[model samples]
Target chain A: MSAPLFEKIALVGIGLIGSSLARVIRRERLAGEIAIATRSPATLARAEELGLGDSYSTEAATAVANADLVIVSVPVGSSGAVAAEIAPALKPGAIVTDVGSTKRSVIAQMQPLLPGNVHFIPGHPLAGTEKSGPDAGFADLFENRWCIFTPLPDTDPQALERLSEFWRRCGANIDTMDADHHDMVLAIVSHLPHIIAYNIVGTADDLETVTKSEVIKYSASGFRDFTRLAASDPTMWRDVCLHNKDAILEMLARFSEDLASLQRAIRWGDGEKLFDMFTRTRAVRRSIIDAGQEIDVPDFGRQVVEHPGAVMPAAKS
Target chain B: MSAPLFEKIALVGIGLIGSSLARVIRRERLAGEIAIATRSPATLARAEELGLGDSYSTEAATAVANADLVIVSVPVGSSGAVAAEIAPALKPGAIVTDVGSTKRSVIAQMQPLLPGNVHFIPGHPLAGTEKSGPDAGFADLFENRWCIFTPLPDTDPQALERLSEFWRRCGANIDTMDADHHDMVLAIVSHLPHIIAYNIVGTADDLETVTKSEVIKYSASGFRDFTRLAASDPTMWRDVCLHNKDAILEMLARFSEDLASLQRAIRWGDGEKLFDMFTRTRAVRRSIIDAGQEIDVPDFGRQVVEHPGAVMPAAKS
Candidate 1:
């Protein structure tokens, strides 16, 4: 095996992403000493029980002391608080980073709190499941996924490269973009989708005619997919919405406008328009499959991923 | 192995569901002979290539002739045509059924044309994937899923019991509901979700600010879930919308009303309302998990079905 990437790595906020990183780092022997910290005493105890780190503490400041690298995997809204808590204790030249979905907000919240001696790079690993908490993490969570970093101007390039290599070892391909661009992109792709999922699921729950049993019974059709996303960590998503407000609202506005148009088409029975839009979206799924972003399901549950191209339908025009 | 349930079974329209039934029938020895037919010669040839049946034909009449049981699994729009085509050829006392998403319409379109001598029981196997065509099918597709049959008033109880047993051997529990109730239940659980997914994916595809590459790059958040549903069979879905117009429109109206309320909450920053709705929906997912309807994800890629009550979250008040 290759040499350990750092002598010590401190992971603040031992949630899904953090614990997953901890598991992968331990499995790969990428860090000599692992320090885990979270605000909740129960969660901290759970992390200790899982043996996810060499050291565990409820104090963020204590966890980052003398660590060569510190990863703050808290919600975007909590980034500033965690950064403030650990700033006085961070070792000089320590590469400080975060794994928040919204990049710009996290950078805005965290960058000002960290000491100038430490490198503050905002990163988001484009991977996760609907599950949350320490026990919800696994070593292979980042495999074949993208880890994007948004570095500020005047940032140390070497530190950036080192962090990139760190994520690569954790089984993620690295990409860099400006923080604002990352927020806008994620708003369209991730945040908006979660918001819509939560909305639709809420809609189903509020229905007067449709019972919950019926929804669960017939969910194999399409509702089940949204349920998985809607079932995500509520606290994390609530923080995401509040932190990435502008971008999410913008995306939501655009989505509403497009939905209005679709509603019009459906009301008018414009099959051609519906067919055209539906046909175009099929290609994006193909592109994602080609990019290895998702598993190809011939039928969602029946056909396993035996052959790559065999599972997806032929790309429709 | 058990004795064949039917002397000969004819599947008229060998697509995803049809071919899956064919495979399951063969695997369980449910039929002594299988005849597959579709309007498209190419699909028929493909079904033949997959060895989905003992006989393959493009003519529906030819396929159903002399068959003890005939299952018409086609797009909802084609039910009338298929019914007319096969009506004269059906054997006396044969059991005929369909596996269509929209049952009321299928019954409305098909029942009059089918020979009265045959027991015309319309059914909907509430299972499917985004993928279609003969190659997308497997023998285990219906395992542990629900199959709802909306039998006509004059339908024979013996024929109904026999069909229920057949579905049981194919790994499904059967429920009987009126066609209208089935349509209403599915409208909320299935149709609305598909429509919403198609709408969101189309919205993302048409975005001017968020580039296509950006959507694909960061889709792991929640948008990717919608993409799977959006990538469903367009022809089949289009027919569903047209046939089940009233139910779908009613459900869509409810969804839009709830969405408007959600949008207002977001706009007004009503955290309490948002939290309440989000919290309530989380319980629904827990119930679904408890009912053995979903797989638990440690992370998104790694999925396993947990034992009942193993992963149940705390119930929301």
Candidate 2:
């Protein structure tokens, strides 16, 4: 491993992203001494049992004490509390950052509480699965994924580059953007999709005419795709909805308007209109696949059922 | 190969589902002879090149002339036209079936046209990927997947059993249900999900607020899941929406209502309500996984980027 990037690095949350960060830090030797802290004792003990850090504590302030860098990976809603708790304990010239879905709200919550001598940069890693908790994390979670920083205007350039270098060591490509712009981009790509998935799955469950068992049995057809996103962490998503309220509502309104028009087309037996919309959206998936955001699966990458007597090359997803 | 189950089997409209059926039948030696037909001459030529059949034709009538079993696998909207074209050529005691998502409409369209001497059975396999056309199919597409039949009340029991046996030989589990019930169940499990996916992807694409490139780049966070469903065969999905208008509309309405409440919760900053909704949806995903319809993946079976220092066995999806 290369020389340590920071003398001491504090991770203020030990859930999926936090634990993944800790794993990557240890793997790449990014920190000389790693400090892990979480509110729950069981989770802190689990982190210790996993040997993810050199030091551990339940108090956020204790974890950040004398740390050259502190990374907060909590739900966006708790940013203010964590910031207030750790503010007084942060070392001067320390680089403080967060991994939260929404950027603007996080900045609003943390910027005032953070000491003036410290660097406050807001960041979000555009990678994750539906899983949560420390055990759900893995070492390569951020590999080849984008980690975006919504740095404040007054942020130190050297501190930003140092953090960027740290994320680069964790195998992520980095991009910087304004906080409001980051929030809007994330609202469409992340927050709205989760809300919509949750809503549709809930609707399917509450159907009076169709039994839940049938829905569960045949979900492979389409509905199961939505469930993956719907199964994401409840607290994190709840916080996302509450913090990213305006942008999420805007996306929801547009999505519903588009859906109503689609409904009308179906109602009128407008096959041509339906076909056009269906066909148009296909190009978007192709673009995403072309850009490497999606895997190149001929199907939805259901490799288990694909080894049949067909002439096409097997896509062993 | 095993002994042929039928003297001959005819497949019309050689797209993903139809071609998969052809591959399975040929692999299992389910038919003495295979006759493939499609409206498109180019598609017929491609199927011939792929060795998907013993005989190829552009005429559905000619393909089914002396066949003991004919599986019409066209778009749902074309069910009536196909029935009208092949009605006179069907032999007495022959079994007729169509694999369509909307059973009631397919039955309503084909029943009146088919000869009374022929047994008309409606079947839908609850399996498919986003891929379409002959080249996208494989032999094991139906393996361990459900194939539901909405048979006519006056249908011959022996013919239904024979058709069911053919599917069983193709590695499918079979069930019988009312056509109306099949339509309603499928509206939730299949149709609405596709529609919602199409709508969301379309909305993201049409956004003046967010660039298309940005959406594509960040899609992995959540939007990419919906893109898979939206990338499904347009002609077939269009037909599904048009054919199952009532059920699709009903499901859309319910989905929209639930989504409205979710939007309200976000707008009003109702954290508890949002948390409850998000938490409840996770159980639906668990049930789907437990029922063996979905894999137990933290994500949508994406095994890559999961090497985050965990000891869990690799999910090589």
Candidate 3:
């Protein structure tokens, strides 16, 4: 299929993103050979058992050897260690990148350790589900999604273009922004939402007045939506909160301030203010739908999707 | 199907819930006649055009006259006014019930205004989407959902049983709790989540560092989930906020307190604490899935649901 893009590609930390990349690359024939690596022997063994790669190893250095393209998909907190482990074996002129959620922290952690001969273009793919690990990934995980690259000022244009083409072939559109701006953007969109979700679920769990069984029973109302985000990989999220501390803290402060104002409105019975705020936020969802970032169906199409052949409301009569 | 549950059933509001009730009642042949009423002439006209009822009126009193059963499905704030208007017109021995989020408020507003000859019961169906209005309803909206009834202590048992049967035929399981307990339960499960969603969306919208467009574009990462709840009907949510102020504020206070502690953990880079909280929340989602309250698919099955032929990751290689 249009010739392999790279002779050899190495994927480090074969979790959801890494395994999905392996599947998509194989499907598109993007790489002539695939090498997989993770710190855990069990995960590496699972990857080999699933036939995800031509070669598998628990040693990151071994996987990076002779690889023309290397992707690091470890937790943000482990970026430095992975970079240190793989730097000595990376082939000359190989293009290296990552799918970390936080750009600045990852760049800060990896840039100095990576050999200057390799092109280290920092990236964050704005795609994924609440689930993680090798088995949770799907070949089309990046379909119609955005894969943002935060390239350094002195980065090579040719290497950046090649990486962009690679992501495009994997079914993701590309955007390039400065690393700080990327962190700030992701802090609000990804990090803050996950943190808030985890906190709210914790709050619901700690309730003495309402039983856990009751919360679980009636969660279809709205609380269940947060549970998906809350159920994400704890190690990954813990790393995110630790790595992107400033931006996340800033967004959290703003969120708390706004929540205080909303609490006050409820306390004062300010229907007008509550209505105005609720109405304004509705337009945001509409904009997201128009932008093709979300499904147009109600409740994310859960009812119809979960129960195929269920009667459509309009057709019931 | 079976013999009609009532000779005539009156609906005093024609919004999403009311219209859905009309459609379901017609589908099951649960009523000999369906009378629909709404304060908005436009909505009433639309309901008639949709063929959702046997008769339509702008006057709640006219709609309830001579009806064997009456269901009030209006914003919580309008419950008292509708109760007052229809009390004189309700047939003797008629079962009158309301579907409001806050049970105590609806009981307070409707109980004293009703005649002693009629049976007054309060109910809340825990089903709906972010959509509203007459056209946004379907017959199956209540299927497999919870329809909670908070009957007054002195309520007629036979009437309550009949009402329970009606909701069951409409495709909902029934639960009964005290008015105060129902409010508290819903405050944590429903009201708090909506308020948090509205607040978070407002916070993101007001951000200066992160543009609104950026937020919308990257929303799939996590922010979009909150927007669905934020996109719910404004008047309904506002009324819920005002009418259920005490329970909502109490839940909101607990949420904020929990959030503050989570914030401290992040600010201090307490990875152990963050990971523990995140891990603990994962089990709650599992409990929800195990209870058959949620779908087992990852990402709420959005990827496959939105694009039917998309490759499953396991099938790709």
* Best model number under lDDT: 3
**Positional deviation of B241 in candidate 2, in angstroms?**
1.0
Q: Which ten residues in a row are the worst by lDDT in model 1 chain B?
A: B308-317
Which runs in model 3 stand beyond 4 Å of their true positions?
A305-317, B305-317
Give every collision pair in model 3.
A138-B313
Query: Could you tell me the TM-score of chain B in model 3?
Result: 0.95
Q: List native contact recovery per candidate, as a fraction of 1.
A: 0.45, 0.76, 0.73
Worst 10 residues of 1 chain A by lDDT: A308-317
Comparison by lDDT, 1 against 3, better one: 3
Model 1 clash pairs are A129-B300
Residue-by-residue lDDT tens digits, candidate 3, A1-317: 36799999999989999999999999999999999999898888888889999998899999999999999998999999999999999999999999999988999899999988999999888888888888878898998789999999889999999999999999888989998899899999999999989999999999998999999888888898999999999999999999999999999999999989989888888889999999999999988887777776777666663354322232111
Off by over 4 Å in 1: A1-3, A299-317, B1-3, B299-317
Each model's iRMS: 10.0, 7.3, 5.9
- Provide the TM-score of chain B versus the true chain B for each model in turn: 0.94, 0.94, 0.95
Q: How much is B290 displaced in model 1, in angstroms? A: 2.5
Give the candidate number with the greatest TM-score: 3
Query: Regarding DockQ, does 1 or 3 come out ahead?
Result: 3
